[model samples]
Structure formats: structure tokens, C-alpha cells
Target: MKPIFKRPRFGTTSTAFWAATIGLLLIIAAVAGWPNPVIFVMGAILLATGLLIWQEITAGLWIGLSVFGLLTVLHLTRAATYFQLRYLIYSLAFAQLGYECWRGLQRTRDGIDSEDIDDENGDGEEDKPMISLVLLQRQPKYLENMILTKVVESAWGGDYSNSDAQSDDDADDGDGFVVGESPMFVIKAPAGMFLVHNFDVPYWDNKDEVVEAIGELRLRNAVEEHTAWLSVDMLTPGDEEPDLNEAYLLVAKLLTALADEDTLAVVRPESLDLNVWSDDVVARLLTPGAYEELSLPDNAPVIPIADDAPEMRAAIATAQQRWPEFADAFQQRASHDKADDGPSFVVKAKITAGDSTEFIWVDVIGLEPKFVHGHLANDPVALGDLKLGSQVEFPIEDVCDWCYEKDDEPVGLFSLEAIRQIQEAQQTNEQ
Candidate 1:
């Protein structure tokens, strides 16, 4: 039997407090010349705490505190005479831990870097510009953490930022500077393309300060049709959300420059015209029953469904009589889906198209007409291209035998609007 492991529950603040307490006790015990076993246990507890709940600055502070506490205790007790060679070695270990903590602080300030590439569809090649691209930048503050801390707290996901306490206007106090919304633009002509450049706005402490920071960060750039991406440093501190209107205007000005091919030879851009696609055309393609009338079946059960369907047995029996050489083969295929209770039905028949007669398996599922309304199924390559998921009028002489079934119970699917309502209801229940 496999053993089940429950997730560990550790509150961030509580864990930090306990880790600091244990570290302090360990430092005191080591300095006070406590019993070997007692000092060893304290050291173990301190190590576990540091490993579990670690923040760079907090860990650094704890290490510094412990080192200073140990030094103070040694000075009080004549360290030269009272401390043995082993005790000196223990101090060196404490120094090492302190040094590691210092290194961690430096790493946190440096921040971390991450990169992801979007090659349009899952395909490797990047050719035409009809591809839509979006850039999402998650600031370093969110990602900078030790691997252990990240793994342990991954399930308890939350934004650990002062942004929550900050009012939108607080970041706006400086020189009316604001981080604007992500910019979106369309490049037409040579290739149809849509691009969204998401700019992260670091905390704007003051307008002049932010302006200087933006310059230092190299936030200014002309957007071109061929422009692949915009880069920002990990050290940049940005607001949670920026002003969209400003961002849109900034992109618009850049777009105008790109359109002027006379000056900029690389890009041959035109004015973005999105009104070309008519609402009616879009509705026809997306709205159920708008493009093609639905093909729904009546509730009437024309034949036994599933295993009870006589057509399956009849087809096999007839095949065996007509083609004795292939009787076993025919029976083998017919034996499938022989259950009395099932949503599917199996039928076999010889279909004639043009001059050729082909034997094929006819698999059918019970999809009530009401539930599958406004849907049409058609084969682009076949001669009878319009009969895929469309409504079928019953009593067709061509269909020698068919099993029919109606949906009397809910089958766990709904339209777009119905789905929205269900989601709202679920949210209400959760609340």
C-alpha cells in the first residue's frame, strides 16, 4: 500500500518568530558553556527553523544576532581559558552561517531573472505576422526566494507585496506620474499582426524620482512592426496596475512613426482598421444555428438502442450468410458495444456512393436535438459534405436500421450563457 503524506502547515510570521527564538537560544547555550547535549539539541532546533522559514533579511539578522550574542558571552567568561579548541571550531561554524546569511541578502537585492518564449502556435516556425502575441512580466519581488521556501509555500499562494496597503493614488503622488496599462497594437499590410507590450511600472515614490528611474531603466523605445519584445531589469519596482489610457496613447504615437515608411524603411505599416470584419459575419460563424440550421432528432425511439439494437445482430447475421469466409470477422466487430445500457449505438451497413459500395461501421451517440441545436457537422472533402452534426429528419429509407434514444435527464453541459449563470451560482455558493 502507498503511504499518504499530508501537506505541512506553517504560518509565515509564526515560523519566523520560532526560528529566531531557537537561533537566539542556540547562541546563548553555546556561549554559556552549557552541557554538550543541551547545546547540540538547541543547535539542531535552530538549524531546522532556519531551513523551514527563511527570508533573506530575517535570516541575516538572526545570524548577526547569534554571532554577536556568542561573542558577548565569550568576553564575559574569559574565553582564552574557559573555551577549548572544540569551542573555537564551533565559533567558526557560527561565522560560516553568518557569512552565508550575508551572501543571501546580497542575492536578494540582485533579484532573479526568468524568460519564456512564445512561438505562436505549438509549431516551431515563426513566419507570418497574423499571429497574436502577449507579454506578461512578473516582477522579481514576487519570484525572489530560496528554493525551499518556494516549494514549501507554493500551495498557499498570495501576493506578498506592500502594494495591497498602497492606495492607487499613493503611487501617483509624485509629479502626476503613473504606470499606465499595457499597450496593444495591430500591424497590417505585409502581415496581419497583433502585439501587446506590457510595461511594469515600478513604485513611483515621486514624479522626478520615477522619471529618473525610467530613464535609468531605459523604458523609452519606439515600437516597430518587427519589434520582438521590450526588456526591463529585475530590480525595477512597479505598481500592480498602470493607467491604460496613457499606455494606449504611447503605443499610438509609436505606431504613427512605424507607419511612416519614408523615414523608417524597415517597417511598411498601415493604419489599423478593425471595422473591416462585419458583426453579422462573426455572428454567423460563432452563434449556434446562425450559420446553419440545427439538426436535432425527435424523442421518438425508432429502434432498440445500444446492445438491444437489432440492426447490429442483423448486420452480422446477414454478413455471415452472404460472406461465409468473413463470418468470424463480421461477428467479432458486431460483438463490440453489446451492452443493454449505454449512451452509444453500433450499426453496420453497406453505403453506396457513386458506383462504389463500401462496408463501414456506423457508431451513433444519443445527443438530443434540443441540447445539440444550432450545430452543423459537415465533411469538407466528402460529397455529402453537409451531414456531420446537423439535424436528421427521421424515416429515411436509406438508413436500413438505426437505434434512437432521447435525453430525459440532464447530461452536464450547457450553452455559453447557461454556463456563465452556473459559474455565478457556484461563486454565490462559495461566498
Candidate 2:
């Protein structure tokens, strides 16, 4: 497999640690005239770590370290009486690595200059925004609250001097400060939106309103002129895009329109990328061939029936106890579906067993895939899941198998809240 690890981004925390570790080794090699083999090994490490840093300041460090270590190795090994000759090659390698690192940073940074075109949906000739978008699907409100607090605190406490120097440099370059005081924007759509917001907001409340309104608007689209009920069926092959997905595309189209009209700030989350979970729940539920099912929340607000719906409450609790993964996915999915209108491009999955192979659909349903409304499947069906299909296997196994064999259905998923209620219900039933 191509490397799973992301090469280090310069200016990140990890780069510092790597520098320090390499620094200590170099010092030992320099001071004690360590063995030739040990010295060469240290130099090799320096070369590798420098490349991984992906930035001039840090990458140069590795080159320097490598050259120093290499020279020390040559001296200790006594390869030649004329150390001067050997120094020439090591010096050349050092210069080459340094020049490459510096030029590479400029080239890469230059590509990202398209940040000036805020009106485009990050589709310009330049690199996609230096900004990374993350999705926090079907996350619990309690957990969100805790994490959000940290984000706000980090923003407030972060150093601004470097930011100021950078801004000045951008201005001097004629790019004219590609970004302002807020390098990041924070907005929340209770459900989710497929479109990333890109405008200035005076307060968090306004941002929240704009996001929530988008979700409300998209939900309106799903319903007909006069109907509380929504009709969803087997997705035709050509109907690759779901209703929410279409809503998101419309959102992108609208945002693109706005960008064309004005100089927007490009409202986007600071940490909305996905690093984990539920890649197959969508296919298992929607595809007929897959034979899995679930009742969607369908863009409705969760009217916290905290004291009312005894069954839902019980189900949440019981599922949490018996199937933590299911309960988590259920609650997360509920939040995701109810919170936004943007399409969360969920993945479609297919699984094959002894005899037949089946297709299933899975995805972040509401607008934005990130935020509260994410989940894996945990439907609690009748027959147990045979766990067939090699394709169905994923790093994230949030789905719970209830029925298999004759039932021949896929597993169900749930967010944490749903599992909590399910857990309670199971306890009640057992008692």
C-alpha cells in the first residue's frame, strides 16, 4: 500500500519534536566522535526527517544535520587522509537538499495563492484553500459543546504576532493580505449544508442562523407543495445524487453566484475534516440488493422528547448498553439528518458472500457531512447479519448485525444517543 502516513506539514507541532530528537543525536555524534556506522545512521535519519518536514526552515535543518553527521562519519572511519576531498561531496548534497526544500516551499505556496479568488468554490487555478475542511457527522451535542469550547479558547489564546507578520508579507507581495484577522471562520447549520459558507459575520449567532436557515431551506425542497410525508424509493442507477446531495449542489451553485458578485471572506470551519468512521452504512440501507433498512429523521428538528417518548428514550439507553457502536451511530445520524440540508456525499458499499454479492448505500445524508448529523448503521433488524461481502469490511464497523441467513439483510447503525435509548429499552425488556 502507498504510505498511510501523511508526510509532516512544516510549522506543525510534530516538526519540532522531530527536530529536537535529531538535534540530540547530532550533538552526541559531534561531541564524542561516535562510531562511523552510528554517525552515518544519524546522518541518514537527518536526511529523511528533513524531507518529511516539507518546509524550508525545518527541511534545511535536516540537511544541515545530515551533512554534519556525514562529515563526522568520514573522519571517524578515516576513509581518506585528505578529509577535504570527502567534504566536497557532503557539502554538495547539503546545498542540493537545502535548495530543493526552499524552492519546493515557494512552488507549493505559490500554487495556494489562488486564495485571493474567494468568489470561486475553491475551483480556481490555485491550490485549494490553505484551509482544510473537516466533517463531524452525527456527533453528540454534549461532546460538541466540550470540543467547541476548546476551539474558541484556542482562537482567543493563539499568538497573533506571526499572523501580523504574515499579513504584512502578503500585502507586500501584492496578493494583498489573502486573509484578514480571522484566519478561520466558525459557523454551524443544526442539520448540515453541502455548501461551505464564505462571508463575513459579526457574531457566532448570525453565523449559526445563516447555517441553520440553509438547512431549513433545503428541507423545504424535499417536501412537495403540500405534504408532511416524503416519498423515497429505490434509487435509480442514474439517480446517483440523493435529494440532500442535490440540495448541496444548489447551495454550491448559489455560493458560486454570491462569490461572483462580491469579495467574500470564505466562511469555512477550522477543523472539519474526517479522519474516521462508518464508510458503509449508506449502501446497506438504501440498496434493495443489500436488504437493509432504516427510518430516517428526514430533516426534522429533534424535539428532544426527553420526558415524552418513553420508547425512544428506552431504546437509546438499551442500545448504548448492548451495542455502543449502534447507539452512537443512531444518535449521530439523527443529529446529522435533522441538522442540515446540504448533501453529505456518503459512500455506496457492496458486499459479497458465498453465493451472491449485494450493493448497499451509505453516506452523510444532510447537507454538510461534518458536525452533529453523522452515524453508522444499527437498525436492530430481525435476522442476524451474516457479515458477508468483503467490500463491506471497513476500518469503521459502527453497524450492528441483527439478522442474517434467511433474513439476508445488512447490519443497522446508530449514533450514541440512539444507542442510549436502545440500551434502556433492552434493560426494561430484560427486567
Candidate 3:
């Protein structure tokens, strides 16, 4: 048997019809001069009060009472001619007010709460799949007319919003984003569809500058991260798993080009799903020198993932699938095989001498005066650059700690995790 469907009592069409009828009456009353425009406007307002119980009980009640009081006073004091012309209009408003009061009370007695109205009408629908992106130290100039645009254009499917207003050159300008400005855009690709929008970083000193790039990916999901890493937010259609193959191809094309330019980046999805990322794309990013601290600007921080983090493991495993060279390099670095003669307690430290601190990690070999004895970490791209892996000594008070490698004992300035693990182990042993 076919299912029976009931018509909604207050659907859009019925509401529109009533609203239109009242509006037409207001226009006719103005022409005939039967009632003042104020009376007809009050009548229209009463209709709104009848539709919304909360409004009728709240502000609407006071408005209705005031209008009636004013009209009654005017009727008693005014001449016969004045009362006769406006009587019909005033009566219509009064009848509307009475109907609103009656309906509002009836709805309240029936236990129909205002909040449930939207649920009954299915007004709050689920959003489409989406993801967000954030880019730091952004160079919009690099994205202009580059191979990156070509890849995105090649996958150009179409967009929901106007695309004619935007061009690669237009997006390249710093005017696209100003301090406190968040612009939104939509781009379609054969691989997937998504939106791009900006968010403010209030804590950042350059809040007003358009130097940084931050964006969202509608139809894809994003996860929060401590470090400045590019998030892989590929979009997908509803009720469908993401097409990993297409996403991988797109990422490979984009990241490979980025790496060729020696761009130091750390990109991850808002949420990590191994099935959504192919092996090639992961290897391209995690490849040893692809995004090493040494390759970045002096003192530029690394991605901040712990040695044993799942993301690092995933990258390593993905690298093993297609890029053995990157896999080997990633494993070596993840193992912490950097050259240093200092004790395990002496973690990597950055020197803060002046306006710009030294950009390389130093080996703290001595205490008392706090001496650093080592060359700056070598940058693969610019090997042996000046000040890199250079030996320098500073007061113990002058060094700023960036990160701590895993180590045992109450070594100098170890990470909180290392300290907590040691205390737990010691407690268990005593027990």
C-alpha cells in the first residue's frame, strides 16, 4: 500500500498567501483613506504575532495593548467623521489581536515548544563534506601563473558561486586578504569540489597583514596541529568515500612542484585516514630533506611530531611503498641519528642574541656559562651556508629552548612527557 502523507498546516505556501493578502489590504486602505496606515500596519503585525507564540507572549503583547489603548482614547475624543473612516481598520486590527491571543494560548496548552518547530519542518539539514586549510609564511606570488594553477585548472569541473571575478593574478595580490579580512572562494576539480576561506589568528602579531595563507576545504575534514603544516583537506561527495587515487595524483603533482622549489612545508589532513592517502603523496612530503629544519630559514621550527607519533609512522610506511630513498631518510631522522657529542640531557637549543636569533639548532656541550660547541645543522639545499653548524658559546641564560628530544634522567630542560614517564617508572619500581 502507498504511504499516507499529511499536508503541513503552516507550510510556506499558506504563510506566503496570508502575508500577501494582508499586504494587499494595506495598499488598498492607503488609497481609500478609510483607515490610517498605522492601523493597517498594526493588523499586519498581529498576523505575525499569531504565527509566533513566543513573540505574541513577549513583545507582541505590549504592542497590542498599547495600540488598543491609543485607539480607544482616540475614539472617545475624536469627532464622528474621524471615527467612522478609521473604524473598519481599527476593528480589523482588534480582531487580529484577539485571534493571536487565542491561538498562542492554545499552542502553549498543547505543549508545543518553539524549539521543536524547526525539527518538525526539517529546517536544520546536515552540511556538505568539507575541510579547512592554513598556510603560513605564504607567498601568493609563487602561486601566480605557476604549475600549481595549471594542475588546479586541469581538474576544473565548475563552481557553485561566481568564478568569473577571480583569476590567478587577482588572487596573487596581497589585496585579496588584509589584516582581519577573511575572503571565501569556491573551486571545483575533477578530483573533488570544495570551498576556500580564511580565519583570523588573533595572537599573531601580523594579524593585519596578508602575508599568511589560511583557508578551508568544504567537503573535506581538517584536524588541528601545533606546528605550521599544510593540511591535506581533499573534498568528497556526500555518502561516498574519498577517491584516494585522484587525491594522491593531485597531491603528488602539487607537492612535487613545491619540493622542487625547496618549499619547506608540513601538510596533514584535519583527520588522518590512511585509506584516504596513497603511498606516493605521503613519501613526497616526508622524504628526508623535503621539509627538514636545516633546509628551512635559520631557527625555523620543524613539524613538531614526536619521534614515535602515528603520523611519522604513517609517512614512513607510505614512503616504503613507492619511494625507498625517502623512506630510508625518514627512518634515519626519526631515529635521531644527528651528529652531536653532547650528553643526551643537552637537547637542541636556539640562541637569542638579538633581533633575529640564530636559525640553527646548537649542541650545548658545557654548563656553568652554557657553551655551545658544534656546527649549525647542515641544510641539504644550501650546504655549508654561513652560520650553519657554526661553533658559538653563550650565557646559559641567553638560550631559548624550542623542543626536547626523548632522554632519561633529570637531564637539563627535558620535555614534560619525558619527566612524567620517568616519574611513573620510578613509582612503579618503588611499589
**Whose lDDT is higher: candidate 1's or candidate 2's?**
2
**Better by TM-score, candidate 3 or 1:** 3
Per-residue CA lDDT of model 1 for 232-307, tens digit only, reads: 1111011112232333223333322222221111111112111111223233223433222111111111221233
What is the C-alpha local distance difference test score of candidate 2? 0.32
TM-score of candidate 1 to 2 decimals: 0.17
* Candidate 3 or 2, higher lDDT: 3
State residue 288's C-alpha deviation in candidate 1, in Å: 40
**Best candidate, lDDT:** 3
Q: What are the lDDT figures for the candidates, one per model? A: 0.31, 0.32, 0.36
The residue-level lDDT of candidate 2 at 393 comes to 41
* Predicted model with the maximum TM-score: 3
Give the poorly placed runs of model 3, Cα more than 4 Å off: 1-132, 142-235, 243-350, 356-361, 364-372, 375-390, 395-431
| Alpha carbon RMSD to native, model 1 | 25.8
TM-score of each: 0.17, 0.19, 0.30
Model 3 lDDT tens row, 1-431: 11223212212222222333344445445445366777577556645533332323334434444544555455534424443323433444444444444443454557554333343334321222234323322322133222334434443322222222233344343212111011222334445543332222221344334122222111011112111222224444323554444454454444343332222233333332211122333454444433222112232322223446544344334322433332233335436755253223233444544443432345433334234344445321122333444566655343333232434334223234443464466469979
